[model samples]
Target: MSTETLIEPPLQDADALIADMGGRARAAAKIMATAPTAKKAEGLRAAAAQLRGQADAILDANARDMTAGEANGLTSAMLDRLRLDAGRLGGIADAVEAIAALPDPVGAEVDRAERPNGLVLRRVRVPLGVIGIIYESRPNVTADAAALGLMSGNAVILRGGSEAVRSNRAIHAALAAGLSEAGLPAEAVQLVPTQDRAAVGALLRAQGLVDIIIPRGGKGLVARVQDEARVPVLAHLDGICHTYIDAAADPDTAVALAVNAKMRRTGICGATETILIDRAYAAPRAIVDALVAAGCEVRGDTDIAALSPHVTPASATDWDCEYLDAIVSIAAVDGVAGALAHIDAHSSRHTDAIVTEDAAAADRFLAEVDSAIVMHNASTQFADGGEFGLGAEIGIATGRLHARGPVALEGLTTYKWLVHGTGQTRP
Candidate 1:
C-alpha cells in the first residue's frame, strides 16, 4: 500500500475554492430571486435536453467512478446506488422535464386578507436563496437536487461522495452548459471540485454563503453535517419505517403487501424496516412462509419464532432497527395500542403504514403516529415524492415544524407579507 493521503493530490487549502463558490453562488441566488417563471422554465427545458444529449459522456464518467469504487472496497448496495443505467438516466431527464411543467412556486400568493382599516394584506412565496447539499454515493442526487433547487429559484452547491466524484462532475458540466445556453447564471448549480475532507469543513462553516444545508445519506453522515454546519440544515436521520397489520386486516392483503414492502427495492429509505403483526388475526404460519419465499430472513419474538422453525429468535434490539436489506424484524403485538407503542419507541419518524379493514383502527393510527408520511392500506414505498405526485424531491424531511412529509416545491419556499392600502396608513 502506498503511504499517502487517501484522497489523491491532497487539498490542504480550501479557502480559495470556498471563497470562489461562495461569491458565485451568492450572485446566482440574487438572479434567481427575481427570475421570471418563463425564464426558469426555459432553463429547466434546456437542461433536460442537454442531459439527454450528453448521455454517452455521463455513462463513461459513471463507468470510471464504478471501477474506482470497486477498488476502494465499496459494498454491493453502495455500488448499485453509484451505478446509473440508461433507464435511470432517462428518468433523471424526465424528472427535469416534468419540473418544467409544474406551476412556478415563486411569487405565488400564500394568503390574502382584507382588514377593517381598508388595507389589503398578501403573503407571497419566495425562494430560499442558496442551498448546499452533501450526499454519499448517489450521483443521481446531483441532477435531482440541482433541478429542484433551480426550479425553486435557488442556487445550489453539491458535494457528492468521493466514490462518485467523476460522475458528478460530468453531470455538473452538462447542467452548467444548459444554464449558459439559456443565458442564466452558470454558477446556479455548482459542484465541489475536489474530494478533500477539508472542503466539507469549509462548506459546513459557510453560514453567510449558504442559506440551508441538506444532507442525504446514512445516519452518520447526516448527523455529522447537522452537528458541524453553522447554517440551517434540512435532513433525514434514518428511515426506520414500519408497517402494521391490524387485527381486522385481510390475511391475503397483508401477506402480499408486507412481502412486497420489505423485498421490493430494500435499499431505499422508504422500504419497510420493521413489521408489526396483530397476534389476534395474523396467519403467522402462512405469512412467515410467504416472507421466506420472498427471500427474507425473519427475526421475531419468542412466540413468533415458536410458531415456525423458519423464524430466528429476535432480541430487544430488533424492535428498534432499520435493516435496509433482505433481513426483516418482526413482532406480534396485542392490538393497535401495542403496535403504536412499539413504533413510537423505535421509529425514525419517517414513514409508517397500516393495513386494516377496520376504519376505527386505521383512523387512530393515522392520527396518532408521528411519522412524516402515514398511509392506510397502502405500501410504505409510496412515501416518495414522485409517488406522492410531487414529480420529484430532494429528500424527505423528518423535521416537525414548518415543513414535513414529502418535500416538494411548496416546501422549498417561504412566505413574506405584502400589504397595500389606498392612502391608508397604520391606524
Candidate 2:
C-alpha cells in the first residue's frame, strides 16, 4: 500500500536480529537519557511533520492492512483499530506535536530535603532506558510509541502485530525520518523488521538490553509477555469498563453518554463494555433504547428484556467479557453499592465511570471503584493518555506498582536519588 520503496536487509536469524536491535537500542538509550530537552522536542515535532506530510502514503498502507484483515476474518472492531484514514493520521500527527509541546518530564524533582548534617537529597525523574513495545494491529502505535518514548528520553524497540507490518514499516520510516531531521539516531526508534514470533521471545528474553517491556495488545499477547519476559512489564490486562447510571443521573445525559461510551470507536480499549443502571433510576428503558438505536446489541437482565424485545439475555460470561464491539451487557443494580460490587467483581480495574448528580454518590463511587481511572459524570472513553494531556500513551498500565491508568511521558520514567553532600558521609 505504501508506494515508497523500502530496501530491507536480509533476516539472518531471529536471535541475531533481536540482539543487534537490542544492542543498538541500549546504546541509543544511553544517548537519549542525556539528550537535551529541546532536541527531544525537536525530534517529536519533526516526526509530526513527517506524519502529516506523508498522510496519503500512510493511508494507502492502512488500506492494504484493512484488506488483509477482512480476508483473515478479523472482527469489525479489530478491523476498525487497524484501519486509518487521513483524519486519523492527522490526529496521530497532532498528538505527536502535543507531546513536543509538553514540558519535559526528565530532571523534574519529585521532592527535596536537607538533613541537619547539611546533606541535601532529592528524587529526580529519569528515563527508563530502552523500552520494548509489543502491540497488535494498530499502526498508529508506531508513531505514538516513538514520540512518547523519545520525548521521555528513552529509546524504543517496537514489535507491532503481523497484521499491520506494512503499515507499521511505513509509519516507522516517517518517524525515523523525523528523528534524523532532529539529529537523533534513527535507531532510537527501531521497528522489528520481521514478523517472526520468535523475535518476541528473543526480545522478552533480552532482559538487560531492554529496561522494560510494555505490551499494548490483547490479553493473550499481554499474558504471553507477562509469562515469558524476564524483564519487567507494564501491562493493561483488560478493559471490561462499565458506566453506571445513578438514580440522580440526568436521563438525557445518561442516555447520550451511555451510547457514546459503548458505540464511539468501540474497538478501543477505553470503550465501555458494560452499563449498570440503578434500580431506582426511572428511565432504564430509555438508556437501553438509545444504545440499541446506535446499533449496539444489548445483552441484559430480565428488566431490560421487559422493555425491549431487541434485548438478549446476558450470560454469566458476559459480565467479565471485554466485547470491543457494538455490543454491551447491561445489569440493574440496587444502588451505588451494588454497582460498585458488580464492577469490583467483573472489572479488570482498567476504567469505570458513574453518571450522577449526587455528589456523595459520585464521590463514593469514585473512591470505591478500584480502577485505574474512575470518572464521575463522564464516559469511560476518556480513559486515554492523549485526553489526560500526556500527548500520547505507550499503554494503559493497569498494574499498580510503577504506573497505573494512562502510561504517558511521566509513566515512562523512574526517579533516582540525587544527593548533594560535601563529604558529609555518615561516619
Candidate 3:
C-alpha cells in the first residue's frame, strides 16, 4: 500500500475498527520481534530523514491544529505543546536519529546462572509485542512512539487527541513511508483514524491483542484509562513535581535552577509545579522573588506571601494541583525532613529535586525521596527520556513495575528465561 493511503480505513463500528488494527499490529509485531537491529536502525534513520525532508508540510498541518486550539481557548502553555515550528520539527528528527544510534536492548542477556543440576539459565531481553499509546495534543508523540516502538521491536497503535489529528496523520505518513523503505512493514506503526471517544474504550478492551496500554496526558485521561483498561497500563498519574531548596543551598544556584524548572516549557510533565523552601535557608525570599521576576505566577503560603506583594495566597487545593502553565505553588518547610513530609503528602512521585551545597543533605534527600526520578541541584526539567539519552519516551512511568522513570527502549522490553540443559528430567 502507498504511504498516502496509510491513513486508516474509514471509521465504521469502533469495535471492528479497533479489532482490525489490533490484529494487524499483532501480526506486524511478530515480524518486528526477530527483525535485525541494523534494519530497525535503518528504519528509524529513514524516518528521521523523512521528518526533516517533509518539515514544511508537517508544520502546515500543525498550523491548522494551532488555529483550532486558539479558537478552543487552549491556554498559552497548551498552545506551546500543540504548536510545531521548523526548529522543533528538526529537534524531533534529531531525537529519532539519536534513537537509531543507541544500542539495541533486544537479545541482550540480562543475567545468567548455573543451577546444581548443571543447567545454565539466562534471562534475555525481548519485545513487549504490540503497544497501544493514547496521548494528547503533542504531535511529536506520534514520531516518538513510532521510533521507540520500532527500535524496541514492538508494533504501536497510536490514538492521539483530536486536536492534532491532521498533524498526527502527516507525521504517521512519513513514518510509514520510512518503514516501508527500510523493508519493515508499514503496519508496524498505525494511528487510529477516528477521533471518536469510543475508540479509546474499544482500545482499552482489546486486552489480548494489545500487550499493554500507555496513556500519556492529563490526570483525567490517565485515570479513565486505568479505570477502564482490561489490559495492563503504564501510566503517570500526575506531574505535581516539586523542587525543595535546602537550608544549605547556594542562593545563586537555587534561584537559577528554580526559575528554569518552572518556566522552561511549563507545559511539560517535568516542569516544577511546586517550590518548597527550607525555612532555615538564608534566602527563602530570594528564590520566590526570582521566580516572580521570571514571569511565573507564585501562589504561596503566608511566608511566601510575605516575600512579595505579587505572590497570591494559595488555597488548600493549590498544593496538590499540577499546574502545567506559568504558575507555581510555594511553601515553607523546616528542613529536609519537612520537605520530605510535604512531598510525601502531595507529590505524584513522578519527579522531585533538591538544591543544596551540602553533600550530606543532598545524599539524604536522594535516599529518602520515593520518586521515580530524584535529583540534587538540577532542574526537574531534566526528567525526560531524550535528556537521559534514550532518544524520546512514551511517558514517565510513575508506577513501579516493569518500568519506572522514562519509558524508553530498555523499559519497553521484557525478559524471558532461556535454559540449556543436557537431557535433564524432573525428579
Candidate 4:
C-alpha cells in the first residue's frame, strides 16, 4: 500500500497541507506532460481493467461509506451522490475505458501562423501542469479527475469531502496501482490524504506549484474556493438554471419540458429552479396549475398564489435561489424581453432554456441569454456532459473565458505556442 494519506484529518493549517500536494503534483505533472500517448492510454486501460476486477471490493467500500454517511445524518441528495451500486461501478469502469479510447488532447496544434519577418508561430495544446480539485461526496470524482488529468496530460491533486474519505482513498489507490503498473509516475494523480479543511487553503495559494484549481460541489464550497484560491480556478457553481415558457411556445412542449426540468431529478445542479411564464397566452394560473399538477411546489407573486392555492408567496430571495429539490419558484412575465430581463438579473449563468415554437423567439433567447448553455424547446436538465455526447464531464464552467458549458476532456486542456522555422530569424 502507498504511504500517502489519501484523506488527512481536518487540520487548521490548510495552506501547508495544500502546498505539499501542490509540490508533489507539480513534479508528477512535468513527467506526465512528456509521456507518450500510447503509454498514457495503456495506463488508463490498465486502470479500467483493475477497476473491473475489483468491483466487489469497491462495492464493499462504498457500502461502508453509505452506512457511515447515513448514520451521520447526510441528506437524501448527499446519500444519492455517495452511493455506489454494481451499475455505477460498471459505469465508472466504462468511463475509464472510454477515456483511454479517446484521442489525447495534449500536443495537438490549435493554430499556426507565419509572419512576413521570417517568424513562424504555432499554438499547440499542453498540460496545465498541475490541477487541484475540491469536490463534495461523490467518490466517483476520484476516477473522473484521474481520467481527465491523465488524458489531458496534467497531474491532479484531489481533495474530496470528508463524508466519503474512505471510499475516495480506496479508489485513488486503484488508480495509483494502475499508474505504477504502466510504468508511469504514481504522483501524476495524487489524492490529498486528509479531510483537513486547511488543505483547501494550501491548494488555493499554491500559485506556481498548482496551475489551476477546479471546485465541483455546492454553492458554499464553490464560493469558498473562488474567494480563497490564489490560483486560477474553473469554478462549477450552483445551477440556478431557469426555463422560460415563451409567448409562442407550444403548450405541450412547454408543459413536458417544464415538468422534466423541475421534477425529473431535482437534486442535480442542472435541474431547473425557476420557471418564467410568458403572459401573452398563459396566465399565472395556467402555468401554476400545470406545474403543481406535476408535483412542483410553485412559489410566485400574488397572481400565481391566486391562480393556484398550491403556490405560496415568493420572496425576492427566491428569485436567486438554486432549489436543488422538488420545490420551484414561478413567475409571470410580459414577453420575451421580460423573460430575458429576469434571467439576466437572477441567472447563475450556468444553464437556462427557452421553450418556444417560434424560430424568431428561440433565436432571440439563444442569442441574448448570456448563459453557458441555452436550450430551445428542451429541458435545462439536459445541460450535462453525457447529454452533450462527451462521455462525462468534470463539471460545468459558467465562466466565459477558457471553458464554458460542460467541462469534458477538451475543456481540461489549454493551448501552447509552438514554432518550427528553417533557420528563420526576426531582423
Q: For model 2, what is the alpha-carbon lDDT of residue 45? A: 88
Ranking of candidates on lDDT, top first: 3, 2, 1, 4
**How many backbone clashes does every candidate have?**
0, 0, 0, 11
Task: List, residue by residue over 254-333, the lDDT tens digit for candidate 1.
Answer: 99889888888787888898888888975867778898989898998877898788899998887777777788888899
lDDT of 2 by residue, 1-427 (tens): 3333334566668888888999999899989999999999889889989988888888888887787787778998898889888888989999999999998999999999999999999999999999999999898899999898999999999999978888998899999999999899999999998877888999999977999999989989999999999999999998999999999999999998999899988999999999999999989999988888889999998887787999999998999999999999999999999998999899999999999999999999988889899999888888989888777888888878999989999999999999999998687
The C-alpha RMSD of each candidate to the native structure, in angstroms, is 2.4, 2.2, 3.3, 3.5
**Global CA lDDT computed for model 1:** 0.87
Which portions of model 4 miss their true places by more than 4 Å?
Answer: 1-20, 283-290
Ranking by TM-score, best first?
3, 2, 1, 4
Can you list the residue pairs that collide in candidate 3? none
Better of 1 and 4 by TM-score: 1
What value does the lDDT take at residue 236 in candidate 2? 90
Task: Flag clash pairs in model 2.
Answer: none
Candidate 3, which segments miss by more than 4 Å at Cα?
1-11
The local distance difference test score of each candidate is: 0.87, 0.91, 0.92, 0.84
lDDT of 4 by residue, 97-157 (tens): 8888788888888888897765689998888788888999998889988988888898999
